[model samples]
Target chain A: MSDPADPEAAPLSATHPDQPRDFVAPGADRDFAGERLTVDPAGARALLDARLIAAHAAGDTARLVTLYAEAGDSSEAAGDAAAAAFYRTHAYVFALQSGDSRAEELHRWLLREGREE
Target chain B: MTVTDSDLAAVSAPVEQARGLPNACYTDPAHFAREADAVFFASWAGLAFAADAPEPGDVKPVRFLGQPLLLARDREGVLRVFLNVCRHRGMILVEEAARLPRAIRCPYHSWCYELDGRLRTTPHVGGPGTNRHAAIDRAQLGLVEVRSHVWMGVVWVNLDGKAPEFETYAADLRARWAAFDRPLAFAPDGAFELEVACNWKLAVENYCESYHLPWVHPGLNSYSRLEDHYNIEAPGTHSGQGTRAYRPMLAEDGRRFPVIAGLDAQWEEGAEYVALYPNVLLGVHKDHAFAILLCPQGPERTVERIAIGYFDTAVLGEDWAPMRARNAAMWKEVFEEDIFVVEGMQKGRHAGGFDGGRFSPVMDSPTHCFHAWVAERLRQPA
Candidate 1:
């Protein structure tokens, strides 16, 4: 289903926990149970951003880290490099909070951008 | 770097007592990167043909030596090459070859640039639909331009922007073939590409001499004898061989293409093959001409972009398809014949005993001339 909050973002593919799908995380999460699944990636930003907000509200650090990373990649691919870097910063924080191994990966990226000491 | 000053110095030494450039010259990534600066970027490297963007508003994205380049034609009908990177966030502006309507709009932020490469508008740079910004300098943020020149239907780019003018750099070859200083149209079925499992220099070395004609190209020797070939060695400019007994590559029906006007009596029976250093191999005859653009993929790989053109633009139409096909096939066969030998030479370069190998003092002068030219260029400080 489209994220009602940010209607301007690209449409994103939905994820169903029980449904086996392609490896497109940092995109859509396995926990998502969207009402209408999609293949179009035009307003994916709003949908993923909504997902990230919901994960944060639910205190789901694991989901937040992955969602934040996915948002960064989509933003980068869409040519909004500033937004991509911003999302990456959020991903790095959640990665540390969740004790995810991706924290190390994100840390290296932060180092590259001189974001982390 | 695997290539040292001593190895390159061997190029100018006495041929019988000298060694070819070390195998690392063709195998090491670092050495290749070094040449990318001193040789390829500093010289007039082939990028595209004017035929690729014949009309206004045509855009082609090109990657040369791993640098993104976008070729565009403006409304005024002037062709230009740009860095292909957007100024705001360094996004790739154009990723494909297509004709644009008026402007190049960035896919990410929707920032647009005019056909002439001016920063036209920023859809939402200020805010949502607000285009102005006190900090952003529109004029200075225009697309970075690249130094480019066109000659004989081929586009050449000097990334460093320090090389002499194309006319000055190519004066000797231009003066030699001045009769062919006319316009050329690319034949419709005249373009094709080949992937070779060999370093680019191997192809150049293989092309600079005709010593392998009798052995490797037995079919070519049937009509053109080994004795009929002579060397073209204009040091620092270009080097290759010329065939004295050249015959038109006619169709089976024996129809001949229109000859280029004002050709000297020599061209009536002569054809010259020259490697205009860095990466273009050219062939000139009385009726038609062709150029091979070499794209080096890695230490042991290369992609050849071949295009055949004619003095008569009519040769690009339907009636000339058969003749163009015949010419393409003939050249394709000849180029294919050298794949094994060139690939074999690339493999041999890995052997510890291959100390850049030796040059035959008599039959290898043109090839030596090429090596010497490359060494001289690389010898310059980057």
Candidate 2:
């Protein structure tokens, strides 16, 4: 099992072999890049995106799925069709890993030619 | 089973010859107060669903017979009814329907009570002792309990403190429909609450007869003929009619709920609609059952709280949103169709020339049975 805190950890396999080694790992330190950047909307978005990338690299599939779904919603809200489609694909992968048939069905419907923007 | 001479004399004068309970009985302020004491408060009136108070510490507040009543499932999982008012200062203890509070605290003075209606704490009252009296016993200051019984998922409370045992009163109904005693779940979409501008009895009367099915409910008449319906009357106890052509809701695979053991094929086609004495009306079909509690807001206004419970709770978790919407639409249509008749009867009762109208003997026996029951109750000395 991969350590969720280690960004360089191995990707999760199809079979859930055992519980994660660092299942009860200690909390990490919080660091701010800049005072002005902390409050800026664009900075907050980039920070969230970086966190998702870290979560995905650490093999946190549940968090990855939720982040992807949130990203898809934001992209659709901002009229970014290509970005929305990419995030939706990521969400579909995570949903499959999470064993959610309902989400998988919705993802299948969204991937159809007529549904794509 | 014998009618006394007084009982015979009371009912011997035909409904036409005898003056019906006056318009005041349906629409006056003082009369409403009197009926609250004589009828509504005296009898075991249906108040809430048993499922509403399913677990220990589950408490639901209801306004019944113009008084706030709290229905609670105690530590032993026994349902108990109590006046919602605090014993200390008469403040309402619980105002909401669903709460699992460790203690019911009065918002006014913080007098706390246990889930079982025992007074738990009267903070600072006895300690300071500057003005407190020794007669103030916390044990005796428990919330006033009202007599309550749960049958077929309905919670009935007798507010007068003394009434016949619920089992004795409802024994005939129990024997008549004994097979429907399985675990039932409320159908989220099939249940509704309706406010009608009519007396509560008027709603009961309208439900007792099937003569208006063709004219009022054309959709139902298309499926069930008038001849296929029959009145079920247990003399002075309860009255309802049953239909033989009930079609069950089909699953996506056309499967129906398994019928109870010992029930014949006739029960599959059978649907019993019963008005349990004063306020509750229940409709039991093979696949589903629904009940309505006709709560009297005033003489001319009644709130009909209706709920449709299913045979299986698991079915509700399966495609619930769509199935609920479908059932809601169907019930909304049928109940909407009943509004005109109930409201019209209320208006008709006010006419100077109108006597308590005649019964068709064959077609109107159900309604006559209901009228006779009401007349007997009214004639009894309170």
Candidate 3:
């Protein structure tokens, strides 16, 4: 019977070890160099695509922002400016929508690349 | 044909000489549409409960008066109202009640808006990878906001955005119950809805007077007789009945809800039920209060959105669950009892010979006050 409108009635949040993490910090994917994975470039790209699809389906804007940014970074690393801009645009949109501070960084990068007004 | 000024002349007469509003006011679809602008939209009408978007990040999409609206609680916990559409492409936004947590993204084209209704992102607006357009001004393209205010847990909106401030509009009733003015603790389980087969005004008219109580709600006659009630007629604002014999509901274990602090001795057994002008019915007692928003779905249908609240949050705990349930059930039963009469009266409106009927001058002044208010409002130049 607790009033849902009451701020005091909101349930407290606590992290459990067994719970699956739905959030991925921006640029955290770049730290994967320390982990071992014997996948080719195509397999890695497919994996990133799968992760993006899952994040989009879950409506996980934070994850979408991070994954899209990671995709943009990968495209840049491969010297594909057009593809990089496309992925960065997706990241920037998600970042802005989620109110993530990374939107400022993404916007700056897009502006430097002359892809944004 | 619509209910013209001539049709409402009889309703605008003195209480003793007046007939009720004509049948067309209640039975004609065309007249009902006209009332939407003149009677409801032009006045401060109840839109939804503030509880609908209770906490920060909560958002609810509601269709009231056939217009889609979004009710949201911004990050600072302020309740806001906006037209439920994206600034670009005019797509509906926030199709359901849920936590926004960050921003609102239209599913159609992925356009984003901040919880405060600011246009945050318009992806690919300038072309593929470009978001900014020289002609697309984000500041000028935020979600359209409707004029809104929250009082007594009801989110009141003036659709035309021209009504006086809510405090000024409701000044008389606010001053009348100034003592009962305190933080209202919503009884979570105390919310309910009753879809009556009647025009929305019929429900308001039925709630305006208490003359039918002895016969309509016979159960209350034991402790609260017809004579215990008095008319409250505020000419152009509101009208209702006040009962001096109101008794607080008690649980089987004899527990009673806490009374609002600093109330005068009169509220101990006194309570007032008011139909605040167009669409909201309100009641305040020493222990608790209730609000009912009469949402007009069409000419002959109304959904009575009811919510009850107590003086404080004490009734929200597990210890007070039983008492809260008992109190909610008691009011629900009382409200249900009145449904048939309003619906029957709605059906009676179709009777060709019925000339809006007559009122008992001694007992129906509150109802007459409401009828006159509606007639005068409808007669105004649109």
Say which candidate scores most in TM-score: 3
Ten residues in sequence with the least summed lDDT for candidate 2 chain A: A22-31
Per-residue CA lDDT of model 3 for A20-105, tens digit only, reads 24322222343223544456677677877898899889988777777777677677667777777788888877777777766777
Question: Looking at candidate 3, what is the lDDT of residue B61?
Answer: 94
TM-score per candidate, chains pooled: 0.76, 0.71, 0.90
- Where does candidate 2 stray beyond 4 Å? A1-117, B1-21, B127-133, B251-253
Considering every candidate listed, which one attains the maximal DockQ? 3
Cα lDDT for residue B44, model 2?
77
Question: Which residue pairs in candidate 1 have backbone atoms (N, alpha carbon, C) closer than 3 angstroms, thus clashing?
Answer: A9-A43, A10-A42, A10-A43, A10-A44, A11-A43, A11-A44, A26-A70
Give me the displacement of residue B265 in model 2, in angstroms: 3.3
Question: Per-residue alpha-carbon lDDT of model 1 for A28-92, expressed as tens digits?
Answer: 43334444445457555566667768887987766766677777667766777667656666665
lDDT of 2 at B141: 88
lDDT, model 3, position A107: 75
lDDT of 2 by residue, B1-382 (tens): 1224344343435544333444555666676777677666778788888877777778888888679989888767888989999988799888886655356767676566777888754543533211123667776889999998887778988888777899888888888777776677875465678899998988888888888888899877677988889988877667888989887755565655544557767687899898987889988876667888898988899999888777767656766546655666777788889999999989887775654566766776777777676666666677
The window of 10 residues in a row where model 3 chain B has the poorest summed lDDT is B1-10
lDDT of 2: 0.69
Question: Worst ten-residue run, lDDT, model 2 chain B?
Answer: B124-133
